[model samples]
Target: MRTPLPGVAAACGLAAMLLLGACTATGRQASDGAAVAPSPADEAAQQSTVDTKWGPLGPADRDLIVRVRQAALWEIPVGRQAQRRAARTTTRRNLGEIARRHAGSDALARQAAVKLNVPLPDQPTPEQQSWLSEITGKSGNDYDRTAIARMRTADGLLYASIGAVRGSTRNTLVRAFAEKCEPAVRARLKLLEGTGFVTGDTLPDPPQVASAPLPGNPKQPASPAPAATALLAGR
Candidate 1:
């Protein structure tokens, strides 16, 4: 039988009042005195987004910079290995170009990291190292298949991530890096796919967007800027 529930109801009401009071004390109340949660934009605005002179350096911006460095750390080795071990001439030539681009990308990543005061990992992530080890253990056709498949899959994922960062990043340096990286990464994916090893299994499921315009095909590559040359020399 509804055992005189008045006291219990009053106690529950008191607890609810205390919770609302705590929220209001923290300045989380609306004009009408009701507690309201902060919007995502408001929360982000409250945090320090502008951490560098280049502009707002968000977490995603820092991540892209680190990823470029890390990609070079492992991809450069695997690319060189594939250049030597791949069975197809196209694969070797493509991987060689990819390795060379990564060297320049790595230098740029380092320069960006220095400007942003972001520390980068010296080695590839464990998963990347594992992929390297697996490819290293194979040879001839097996090595070609393993390296191409792995690199294609990785490049597909990187391509999507680069697009996400490039579109949303507020930092100028990060945007520049993304602009350069997106094209290079897409070119690498195309190179890998052109080798004819990237079948349905190697391609990322739910295919990533590929709307970024291709860079101009220069007859002869331009020499590095003096500042860029100096940066590379310092490294």
Candidate 2:
């Protein structure tokens, strides 16, 4: 072939260089794109869920576990204080029983926390501590009334929570824990109510009923107040 022009030779050289550069870049990319294992932090993020033989542990289940423990934390002290200060013999006896039950509940809650790998609070919440402080400031009948009212209100709320968890929880351990708490809380409610201190205002409102009357009956007779409601109201 006739000798290539200088310009043509330079153009050819530039093309070859560009082609080589492109091939090298593509090879580098392919090598770098090979599968690599995730880092430890990434693995932890991906495995956020805790699996159990009973079922997957959910946030609600974790909450119930912690709350049960916290309840015992504050209530036990208040009950013990009531045992010392309640003027009525019956109230003292009830407080003693409540303290004993709470101790048992606390022990179970600790064991459950260990088994479930859920961390528990070492002490009561600030609000619970405030209630404890309030009870501690009073004595005799005053202490009894304050302790009963506070405990009843707190226990009533917790009782409802336990019932809800007991009914809905998928984890067998959590369900069992809630089942045990439900009746224990109910029994405590009855005990607190028996102290003649649980007022109507302190009790949680009953579940709402639909106001719409049935097709046949234009007016439904006013439902009788619940026995507990009536009893509390009279106090």
Candidate 3:
């Protein structure tokens, strides 16, 4: 069987818990202030929680938060390397902007981790360190290409995780954090794409809804079309 998406699994698990809690609260109370055995639904809900990590979040939300912080930490050093090693003026400028953006994102991620009482790593994950080493070993056009490709891959993975957290996280803090960082991540991806080093296949899928037309655009209205139209057009 195909594995369920993390967000979906988390949502189902959360819903089951809420339903179980509601049932327990309304359950018949015994004479000695003792609670009766849980119903089958309650048993199933308890089991669901066991299937995933439980706290203020399910497994998916916790994983997403960790990955986001890791990505932020990873990007800062890699972006700096790109700034120093990229030969093209445009590539160097874009990398500089990327480094600046991720520095800010790293701070935000740290703040979120503190508020959520989550422990964040002092350095990037092992896989990220490997990518950094590979990028650092190249120079000129090769460095530019390698750097952009690595960033593209990282951004794509972050994009997917952020999208998942924003949509299904039970914790309000995590949802808000994901929403806040999405635009910068998206903008960085676009900048990397503009460098012509990353290919379309390597990038994450574009947003389903097209952005509003610019002020002077005549072919399309400034206001977005109906959501359905945008979805259909994307397809």
Give candidate 1's total backbone clashes: 0
* Tens-digit lDDT track of model 2 for 55-152: 87765576677778988988888778777788888789898899889877888788888888977777776557777888889887788877887787
- For 1-235, candidate 1 gives per-residue lDDT tens digits of 2231112333233223322321111113344434457677655543335667778787567666776887898899988977888888988998888898888888888998898887777777655677788889988777888888777766665676677777777788888988988878888888888888877654434522448667756987867667767778957
TM-score of 3: 0.63
Q: State each model's CA lDDT, in order.
A: 0.70, 0.69, 0.65
lDDT string for model 3 (98-205, tens) is 888877677777887776555566666555676778889998898998788778766765676677667766677777788888887898998888888886544434
- CA lDDT of 7 in candidate 1? 28
Give the C-alpha miss distance for residue 178 in model 1, angstroms: 0.9
TM-score of each: 0.66, 0.68, 0.63
Comparison by lDDT, 1 against 3, better one: 1
By TM-score, the better pick of 1 and 2 is 2
